[model samples]
Target: MSLIHCPECGNEVSTEAVACPNCGRPLAAPAPTIQRRVIVAEPRDDGFPKWVIAPIAILGIVVIFLLIAITRNNEDEANRTVNVNLATQRRTAEPRDAARDTSPPNRIDVPSSSTTVNPPAPPPSAPAPSYPSSTTTVPPSSAQTVPVDRASVVIDAKIATGAGAIQSVKNEKFYLLDKDLDAILADADLEPIEGNSLADSFGLAVLYPDRYGDFRRDALAAISKHIKYNATTGGDGRAAIKNVEPDSYYLFGITKAKNAFAVWSAPVSITAGENKLNLQPARLNEIAN
Candidate 1:
C-alpha cells in the first residue's frame, strides 16, 4: 500500500483512502491536473503599427488638402486684384472717351449765360469833297514824215576772160564805200573787206551776188548811218541799193574764181525825196599770176 501526505492536514494516508483517519477530514480525489504547452513568442523589428500609419496618412492627406486650399485662395486673391484694377482703369477711361466724343474739334467753349455785346461801329467818314469836273483835251501826237523819194542805185557785173568770152558774174561779193576805192586801197591801216570792223565805218553796204537781190529800207538806212549792212544778190546778178542818203559812194566787187576785184565810183545826189541811178555794168578781169 502506498502512503500519501495530505495537503490539508499533515497526516499520512493510504493511496486508496478517500479520507484521513487521524484527521478525520474527508479528502477529495485530486482533481485531474491539466497540463498545457507554453509557447515563447520572438520580438520582431516591424515598422509602425497599422493604426499609427493610418493616422499619419490621414494627417498627410489633410495637410495636402490645406496646401491646395491655400494655393487656390492665393490664386483667387490675385484674380480679384486684377479684376479690380481693370475695372478701375475702365472707369477712369470712360469719362475721357465721353469728353472726346462730345467735344467739337478746334472750337472755343463759351459759357451759356454770357451775352456778347459788340460796340457800335463809328459813323462813316464825311463824304469826299466834289471838285469841279475838268475836261482835259489831250493834244494829238506829231506824226513823223517819211521821205517818199529816197535815193537808190542799181548795179550789174560781168566777167570778161582773156578769150573775149563774156559771162554774167555769179557768186561775187560787192561792197559800197563812202570814200573812193583808190583812197581805201591806198590806206595801209585799212583792213581787208572780209571781217573788217573798220569797213563798217567806211563801207555803206556789202552785197553777195548769190543770195538776196532785194534789200530792206531799214538796211539802207543803216548803211546811210555808217552802220553795218549785209546783203545778198539774186541769181540774175542784179542788185539794187535803195533808201541811201545824199552822198558819194563807190561800188566794188570781188570774185573768188579768178581772184579778181574791181571798183567804180559815182557822185550820188539824193534829194529830200526820191532819186534813182542806173549804174553801167562793169567787167572783172583775172589778176596776173
Candidate 2:
C-alpha cells in the first residue's frame, strides 16, 4: 500500500494512517529499492583428458626396427650369393686341373698281322734273261783291304837307379797284329848301362835327336817318358785286339841312343801281311857295347 510522511511531526500514514510511533518520526518515505543481479555458473568437465600419443610413438619404433631387419636380411642374401659363386669356382677348378694333368699324349698300341690275297700265276715271263756270273768275284775276308796312315817316332828313356828303374817300368812288351786278327811280331828287352854318372842321382830323363843331327832343345816336350806295358794277354794274336775300333793306332817305346828308353813304331794297317813289329836288340838283355 502507498504511504505518506508527516512534516515536523509527520509520521507515515497509511492511506488511513495516524500518529508517529516513536520520536515523532513517521515512516512516510517510500521503501528504498534494491537492484538484484542475476549470476549464471558454467559447468567444467573434470581435469584434462590424458594425452593418448604413447601407443603411436611405440608403433613408430616398431616400424623402424622392421625396416632395419629387412635391410640386414637383404645383405645376408647378397653374401650368400657371392659365397655360392666362389664355391662353384673352386669345384670347377679341380676338374680343370685334373684334365690338364691328363692331357699329355699317351703311347698307342698297334696290331701285328695283316690279311693278303694271291691270284693264279701268269704264264712264265719270256725266257728269263741270262747274265754272266763268272766275271764278278767276291774278295775273301782275309784279302779285304783297309787304309791307314803311318808315322815313325824315336824315343829315349833311361832310369838312373835300379830303384828308379823298378819304379819307372812295371812290365813292357811289343805287339804286332793285323786287322785280320793275326800276329805279325813282338818282343822286349832290358840291359844295364856300363858306366854311370851323377850330379847326385838326379832322376833319369829321355832325350831325342832330330833327323838333322840336332838334339831337341826341349827334351821333355818331345818325348813321352812314362812308357809301361799292360799285363792283360787275352787279346787276339792277329789283331792284338779283336774288332779294333775304327782308325785307332799304336805307339812303341824306343831303345839305343844315349839315355834312350823307348822307340815309337809307325802305325800299320789292320790289313794282311804288313803287321810285323820288331822289338829292338832282342827279347832278352843284349851285351852292351
Whole-model lDDT per candidate: 0.44, 0.31
Runs of candidate 1 exceeding 4 Å displacement: 1-149, 188-230, 259-267, 270-281
State TM-scores per candidate. 0.31, 0.22
How do the residues 118-173 of candidate 1 rate in per-residue lDDT, one tens digit apiece?
A: 21122254222222211322221112222333334444555445565655545444
At residue 91, give the lDDT of candidate 1. Answer: 95
Which 10-residue window in model 1 sums to the lowest lDDT?
Answer: 107-116
lDDT of 2 by residue, 161-256 (tens): 323331221123333322111011201111111121110001111221222112222222222232222111111211122223333334333222
Against the true structure, candidate 1 reaches a TM-score of 0.31
The positional error of residue 201 in candidate 1, measured at the CA in angstroms, is 21
Which 10 consecutive positions of candidate 2 have the poorest summed lDDT? 196-205
RMSD (Å) per prediction: 42.6, 36.0
